[model samples]
Target chain A: MNKASSALSGLYLLLILFFLYIPIIVMMIMSFNRSELYLLPFEFDLVWYQQLAQNDQLIGAARNSIVIALVNTVIATTLGTLTALCFARYEFRGKRVLQGMLVPTLTMPWLITGTAMLMFFFWSGIGRGLHSILLGHVALSLPYVVIIVGARLRSLGVSMEEAAATLGANGWQTFWRVTAPLMAPGIVAAALFAFAISFDQFVISYFLAPVGTSTLPVQIYSAIRKGFTPEINAISTIIILASMVLMIGFARFSKFGGER
Target chain B: MTSSARRLRAIIGLSGPTALWLTVTVVLPLAAMLVFSFLTVVPVGGREAAFTLKHYTDFFTRPLYLTNAWRSVRLGLEVTFFCALIGYPAAYILAKAIKGRWREALLLLIVLPFWSNSLVRTFSWTMVLSDNGLLARTIHGILPFAPSFDLLYTYPAIVIGLVQSYLPYMILTCYISLQAIEDSLTEAAYSLGASRFDVFRRVILPLSLPGLIAGSVLTFVPVLGAFMEPRILGGQQAIMLGTLIENQFTASFNWPLGAALGFIMLAIVLLIMGLFYPVLKKHISVN
Candidate 1:
């Protein structure tokens, strides 16, 4: 009976995984199909991918997305790492309140946060465009970086830095020589997370994108709303692959879903 | 300089940029949204504006907004219920039934897609659920006499898409909490003559309730504000509070009304979180 139940549980999980992956797999397969109408008896073809390469608007949007995500990664990681260091090393008045500030972006729906950013940016003359989108992306990615790197810092437990100081190294020497090198893997992981967050971000980009220009996601959203084409599937397949690759890198460095 | 003063300076120097960035991008914007919700107009382009409660009042007076608001709540509850139902068992199997390397690999696999582009994943559903899509094609291939059907542009399609999108959150949270349950406690229950069902019901379930609650909140709040999935899958049937607020901003160009609707949704989210705070505090440490 126990063996039967265990097997049933395994089968149940298989079904769930199948459900999770089927739509994504079907989407990828259809991207390679020759038919624009998504008809069956799928003749595998590279026509859609070739067409996607020629699409100037999508190509431009993709360029914009890459640029924004890269910039967002650098800025959010640096600032967030610094803040994580602050939280790790200090016990200050209003520290809890300061940390509480990060909760809104983490917990609140992006719809609310996106619309709020839209209103404020437009009103404050930040105006909608790549700049505003970058700002929003950094804000969204910052908390994740802090949380991930902070966990790493906490695990390091300050002992190494303390030992360095006891050996007559100043704060600068200790941080550069000991702390930074030790924190390298966590920083790399957090930077990858920041990139993925910015790259995969759609809602904020959608709201903040200026007229006639957009990030890849915002562009994809418009295309989906207008109509689906095999070209969309091609771009989506590429996007999913890119995001998964980035996340895999993050998982490797962070030991995500591994032995704690 | 005094040691305390130097420490203060270090804290400011390290944290200032992030604090400033969040203020301009998140804190200030949310504050502006609150102020916008009370305005007579968007207060742009030299348009004279006055404070008014009409937008908030409009939500109460308009049956359409109220009904859609309730629909959004209903959608949240349904999605949360389904996620918990589907995720708990999978989490349990991963946490308890499975062992070692396989458990780690399966957990990673489950979390992988969740980190990928949600927009692309949501769009993927259209291919499988649309009329003459893959599911219909497969069914027809197997049984030529079967009737053709599509699940797209329906409430159930929305539910299905959302459940898939959010299920990993439930699984991850439940798995974390469940893994913390000691094997010895369950062994004790068994040795004390508790049946398998009794042990699960009275022991395992209670121990895992915190994760379940945390996962439910994480799932429910976003589902409450979901727009993209419903738009892609539910078509005209997708007019929940999310889409309604989206229309005010994107189509109607009514910023005030959009802000008001957004706040009402935020209020509901906060109310739910407040209610769950005591339970959440005991089990989850989000940071």
Candidate 2:
């Protein structure tokens, strides 16, 4: 009875994985198919990818996406790590409330956040463009960086920093020599996560992106809305692979699935 | 400097940038949106705007707005229900039935796609669900007599795409909580002559409720405010509070109405969270 039930549950898990992955797998497969119409006698070709290469709008948007994501990673990870440091080391008044402030951005739907940003940026003269997109992306990403790196910080405790201080190291010197190196893996993982959050972001980019400026996801959104093209499939497949690889690296560093 | 004074400086210095960033990006924007929702017109281009409760009142008086708001809430509940229904069992298997290395690997595989581009993933559903797309083609190939049917551009399509989009959240949350339930407890129950159904009902379900609630909140809130999925997949049937708000900004250029609609949506989300607060407090320790 036990063996039979276990086997049945295993089969169920496989089915769930299949459901989760089928659309993505189908998308990746369709990207390589030669037929523009997605008609399948299963002819394979790279024609769409070749066309994608020549697509300037998409290329420009992809460039904007990378630049914004890169900048967002640096800004969010630094600020978030510092805040996590404070949360870890200090006992301050209103610390809980300060931590609670992070929840709104994390939990509040991006649509509301996006529209609110749109209104504020427009009214406040920040205007809509690549810069506004960056502003929104960094806000959405900061909390995640804090949460992830903070998890790492909590695990490390104040022992190492306290040890350095006991050994007569100054604050800056201890941070530079000790804390920085120890936090490196978590920081890298957090940075990668921030990048993914920004790179894959759509709604905020959608609302904040002005006419003639867009991110890759924003551009891809418009492309899909304009109609389906196999070119989108090629780019999307590439994006999925890139993001998956990044997350796998994150898992390795963060021990995301937990230590064996 | 005194140690306490030095610590104060450090605290301010470390957290200041993030505080300012959130103020500019989140707190102020939300405040501005609230103000905008009350304004008579966009407070720009020399337009003289006055405070009015009309936008909030309009939600009560306008049937179209009311219908869409209802639709958005219903969509949230439906999607949340389906995600739980599908995700809980999968999480159960992963947490309990599976063991060790296989469990870790499978869990990673489940979460891997979720971190990727959601917009791209949503778009991918089109290829599989469109009338002449993969599913249909495969169906006809196997059974020539079957009528070609498209699941695309329908309510069910939006649900399917969203369920696929958010399923990992449910599984991941449920898995975390479920795995924390020690095997010894269930074994003890079994040895005490509890039936499989009884154990699940009395112990497992109650213990996993927090993950289930957390997952529901995670799934429901976004799906409630989702415009993109409905736009891409629902087509003509895409009108919801989300798309309505999008239209106010994008098409109608009615910022005030959109702002009002956005707050109403926020309120609904808060109401759900408030209702679930007691359970959430007891189970989930999100910091």
Candidate 3:
């Protein structure tokens, strides 16, 4: 029975990969198709991408997403790195509960968070603005960075920080010169993840965005709801490529794989 | 010595910022929602400053609301079952996969969708399942008897779309747990003449149950409040609790009612997560 089942296992592996990869590859192929309909004929053309570039609403949404994601990434990285260092370097009471922060912040559906944030802002007298969206995003992304960077810290050990203080460099300077550089790769990876999460968030931006301040994801959702076209496919292709490139770049930069 | 102690105190002081962050963002907003759920809704989805349980009473009294809530819960459970069913076997293969440079690439591929925007994934499904979609065209090409595919905005399409998107998460978590189990144990079971099924059932399955619980929580919690897939992918006939909340807020302009519904969904997810919390924290002893 075991020998007979080996053939079945091989088939299962093939099916799983096909299931995972086909949708994405199909989307990529459809993005470039010359047909106006988003369905398949596999015809080749770059016209949709060109159309994507010229569309003002698409362009504006893309621009807004880029600007917002960039700002959110920078702030989340700095504060996340700081917070991770504190968590990793020092042990204190309530650390367990505090560390559980990642579970809710990371796991709760983004739409729920968005609605919650919208209501909170209303009650607190803080009007809807980009800043409010920014605050909400930072709140969400920072916990992820902490977990990623904190893992790196755990491997390195605290001997360096101890050595630095022994050399009379003091805490701040040691962290700035030595620890920061060592942790830079993890920081970069965390930044990539943070930026991607923010860039793609639809609900959080949709609920919290002021009127006329739409992000790309929301813009695309509204567009698709109206109807389907190749332009959205083109935009999606770009996003897919962007994530792949970032993953490759992250792997190249980080020693997370341990120089193998 | 005293100064250093004060400096240590200052470093610990940073926890203040984290707590403040949680209060303003997570706690306060939830508190606001709770308060508003008891208040009155003005016209056009606006909230008035007053206290009343009329919104909850109205929502809970309606059979339609209860039906939608039940639909959402049942669908969530269905998706969770699919994730575990598919995720477990796939995870086993990956855990035993060739351990080299390709491993990260493989793992990254599994996680790739987690990085994509919800809107894009749901919209992608719409394109595939639309009335004139490639799927319908292909079906038409194949057989004359096959019904014309009108899958978009339908229940099956919503499930397929969401399951495809979030299934990666279940696979990855399950893969991690499976890999953490030592191969020696499996080898021992094998030498003892235990069949592959027996080995898996007795040794591997128990070892990875914790991960399964975690994955289910991860999948089901979001699936409960899932708005994007149901709205864009599930046509009008398939309304979910998430969609109901969205309609109340955006269309019906019933903020108080929407708040009540949203909290209801949140409560369900929190309850499930709470039940699974202990399992997630403690490691399962494979031996």
Candidate 4:
């Protein structure tokens, strides 16, 4: 009975994995296939990727995505880490309310948030473009960064900072020397997470991006809706691989499935 | 400044920037949306706009909008149901049957695709479910006399794609809760002459309810607002509340109507969270 149950478990897991991976694998293979019609007996070629390089619009969008993600990572990581440190060290009066405010950004659908930002930005004359996109991305990412870094701070405990104080180290000195180094792994992991969130963000960017200028995901969305092409498959395969690699690095630093 | 004053300053300096940013970007914008929802027109660029409740009333007065809202709710329920059905068992095996490095690696693998680009992932489904796509070809190769398996641009296609996208969330949440359960509890129940089904129903299932509830809320909320999956997979059949709202902003440029629709969607989401708050509070500690 035990053996039979275990076998059933393995089969179920394998089936789920197959469902998750099949589309990704199909897209990757089709990117390499020479057939425009996605025909079988796959003849491999690099033609679509070569075409992707010359596709100025796609190349430009990809550059915009990377730049926004990098800027978002820097801003979100700094703000989020500081917020996490505050939550870790202090017992302020409005801390609960502040934490509660973070929930809507995480739980509320991006469609609502995106639309709300559009309405507000337009009315307030902030308007739409890359700066508006950056604002939205940072708001979405800050909560995750705080959560990740806060978890690590909790694990590290207050003893080190207290000890630094006893040894005649000032608050600034202690933070820079002791707390910062100890929290480095968590901070790095959170930054990578911020980068991934901003990079992969679609719904928010979709709303904020003006005509002729957009992020890679927004550009890809229009390309898919307007026309179907293997060049899309080429760009998508590259994005999936990049995001997967970033996530693997995150899983390593954060021990995402928990410590062994 | 005194030492105590300096300490207070440090705390403010640490937490102030993030709080201020969230207030500007999240709190104020949502407030602005609420105000816009009550207006007759978008108050922008010399447009003649006035305060009115017509946009909210339009939702009830217009049958098309009402039906689309209902459709979105139903889609949320269906996608959440399927994700739980498939994910709970897989999470159980990973948490209980597997051990050491293998379990960790498998868990990471399950969650990897979730962080990748959702637009790309949704588009990939179009490749598999199209008439001449891989699924149909493989089905024909096996059955030989089977009908063409064209699953694209249908309700089932949307459901399938949504399930694939969200299944990892269910598994991850369930795995966290399941891993915390002790193996000896099951052994003890078995020694007391409880059957496997009885043990699971009475012992394991009750303990894991929080995770299940949390996963359902997480899955349902996003599925409620999903526009991309249905557009790519459902095609003409893809008119949910989300897509309707998207059309208002993107196609029609009726910002007030879109704002009203968005707030209604948010109210529904908040209601679900409130109903599940008691269960979720126990699972997710605030600090």
Q: Is candidate 3 or candidate 4 better by DockQ?
A: 4
A220 in model 2: Cα distance from truth in Å? 1.0
Per-prediction interface RMSD in Å: 1.3, 1.3, 4.5, 1.1
Each prediction's whole-model lDDT (CA): 0.92, 0.90, 0.77, 0.92
TM-score of each predicted structure versus truth: 0.98, 0.97, 0.91, 0.98
Instruction: Give the CAPRI rating of model 2.
Output: medium
RMSD of each: 1.4, 1.5, 3.4, 1.2
Which candidate leads in lDDT? 4
| Cα misplacement distance, residue A11 of candidate 2 (Å) | 1.6
Q: What digit string (tens of lDDT, one per residue) describes model 2 on residues A1-260?
A: 39898888988888988988999999898889998888767888999999999999999999999999999999999999999888888888967766766777777889999999999999999999999999999998888888888888878888999999999999899999999898999999999999999999999999999998899998999888887678999999999999999999989889886767
Q: Which pairs of residues have clashing backbones in candidate 2?
A: none
**TM-score-better candidate, 2 vs 3:** 2
Between prediction 2 and prediction 4, which has the larger TM-score? 4
Q: Which ten residues in a row have the lowest lDDT in candidate 4 chain A?
A: A251-260
Say which docking band candidate 4 falls in.
Answer: medium
Q: Using lDDT as the measure, name the better of candidate 2 and candidate 3.
A: 2
The digit string of per-residue lDDT tens for model 1 on A1-260 reads 39999989889989989988999999999999998898877899999999999999999999999999999999999999999999988888767766777878887889999999999999999999999999999999988898889989988898899999999999899999999999999999999999999999999999999999999999999999998678999999999989889988999999886455
Q: Candidate 3 on B76-150: residue-level lDDT in tens?
A: 999999989998888887777447766666666676666666577667666667788767877988886888869
**What C-alpha lDDT, on a 0 to 100 scale, does residue B76 get in candidate 3?**
91
Ranked by lDDT, top first = 4, 1, 2, 3
* lDDT comparison, 1 vs 2, better candidate: 1
For each model in turn, which proportion of the native inter-chain contacts is also found? 0.73, 0.76, 0.34, 0.74
